[model samples]
Target: MGERRSTSQSLVSWTRLRPYAMISPAILVFCLFFIYPIGYMVYLSFHDWNFVSPTKEFIGTANFTYLLSNLEFREVIVNSFIYTFFTVFLTIGISLLLALWLNRGGAIYSFLQASIFSPHITSLVSVSMLWMWIMDADYGLLNWALNLIGIESIPWLTSPDYALTSLIMVAVWKGIGFNTLVFIAGLQSIPKDLYEAAELDHTPPWRRFLRITVPMLSPTLFFLTIIGIINSFQVFETINLMTEGGPINSTNTFVYYIYQYGFQFFKIGYASAAGVILLVILSVLTVIYFKVLSKKVHYR
Candidate 1:
């Protein structure tokens, strides 16, 4: 009887191990690609080394100290925060409004959805090139339109004051479609009966929307907020292709700064420190979002 019981226990243990065995390949890939690289980056952040140098000198936290004290780095940090806030805010706000307007089922709505989402599927490089031509100060489409409206041409990408705003506009336009689709999904998931009941009670449209639609859509909004903020922090491609962090570094975001240090200057250790700083910033923001804002989110 004891032998039989021991056999049963062993079988149960093997059954439990099967799931872990099945996921072992994924675990290995995660460690190899994600965990190991992060660990190496953290280790590299403590040293001072050019990518070409064979010797990595242990300089402790001097890299971080320099970044904190550097005025240019401080400007980069400020630019990163402003870019992230406006991009996320405009993306979510416009997408929500669009979703609300077009949530009803119809052929025209379907066409509009497809048209709005087309930009998202399009290549960023191509979009950036197209926008550059359109935004050209000399005889560009935008300037021509402005002239017709009796307004002078504005330098969208050339002026330091307008460079970052131009990038934000592009980012918001590119991201609006995906978030709109998500909001549409969230809108559809809401029970129609609630709206019907509200209508039967003669609830004002605005009040119903404020009470029902907003509450039900809180989960979607929360999700988009988190994702949008993270993606905004990593803004690089548009800045790289269009502005090159130029107009006297007006658009020099954190990721672009990392690229400058790592590839342009070949200061791998300094770049690693910047990357680590970015990671910490993201982690803290995520935590704060969850702790402070998540309570208002309706998970259902």
Candidate 2:
């Protein structure tokens, strides 16, 4: 009897430990790839070293200090904020409207959804190249269309005034499909009974939407806002391929600035410092968003 009890205890112990053992490989990979690289980046932020340098010199905040004082870096930071603001605001707003318009489950709606989402899944390089041709000042489809409407050709990608706007438009076009899908899911999840009751009570359509749709979709909106802000701050591919941060550096954002410093100029430490600053800024923004906006989110 005592031997049997000991074997049962061992079996129970193994059962309790098995799940952790199963997940150990995933945990190891996460630490090795994600956590280690972040830690290394932070460590490198304090030292001055070119990629080809033999030894790194301890700069101890000099990189951060220089960036803070530099006008170009300051402009990059401001541009990042501007780009993120417009992209997130416009993407979420437009996506919500699209979701509302096509919330019905049907073949037509599905086809439209797929059509919108195709641009998102399409390669960024391909999309950028396509837009470059479309936005060409001379002999481009867009200019040709404008001429049909008796409007003169506008320099979409060449002028400083229009370059950032063009970038924002591309980002919005790419992001709207995903946001729309998320909103559609949120909208569909809402109970039909609420709308029926509102209708029975003679509630107007706009009021019903305001009271029912917006409140219920708050959680979805909150989630999309956070994600959009993060993505917009990391705007690199479009800027790199389309404008190359040209037209008086009007579209030069934080990530592009980092690439220029690290890869182009070989100021590894400065770039790392910029990276660390970006991480800190994102962290703070996320925290603030949760603290201030999360209370308004309706989980159900």
- Per residue, candidate 2 scores C-alpha lDDT tens digits across 230-250 of 989998999999988888888
RMSD of model 2, in Å? 1.8
Q: Best by lDDT, which number? A: 1
- The models' CA-based lDDT, in order, is 0.94, 0.93
Candidate 1 per-residue lDDT over residues 208-297, each given as its tens digit: 999999999999999999999999999888999999998998999999999999999999999999999999999999999999988998
| lDDT (Cα) of model 2 | 0.93
The candidate that achieves the highest TM-score relative to the unseen native structure: 1
Model 2 TM-score is 0.94
Alpha-carbon deviation at 178 in model 2, angstroms: 1.5
Per-model TM-score, in order, reads: 0.96, 0.94
Superposition TM-score, candidate 1 onto the true structure: 0.96
After superposition, candidate 2 runs with Cα above 4 Å error = 1-16
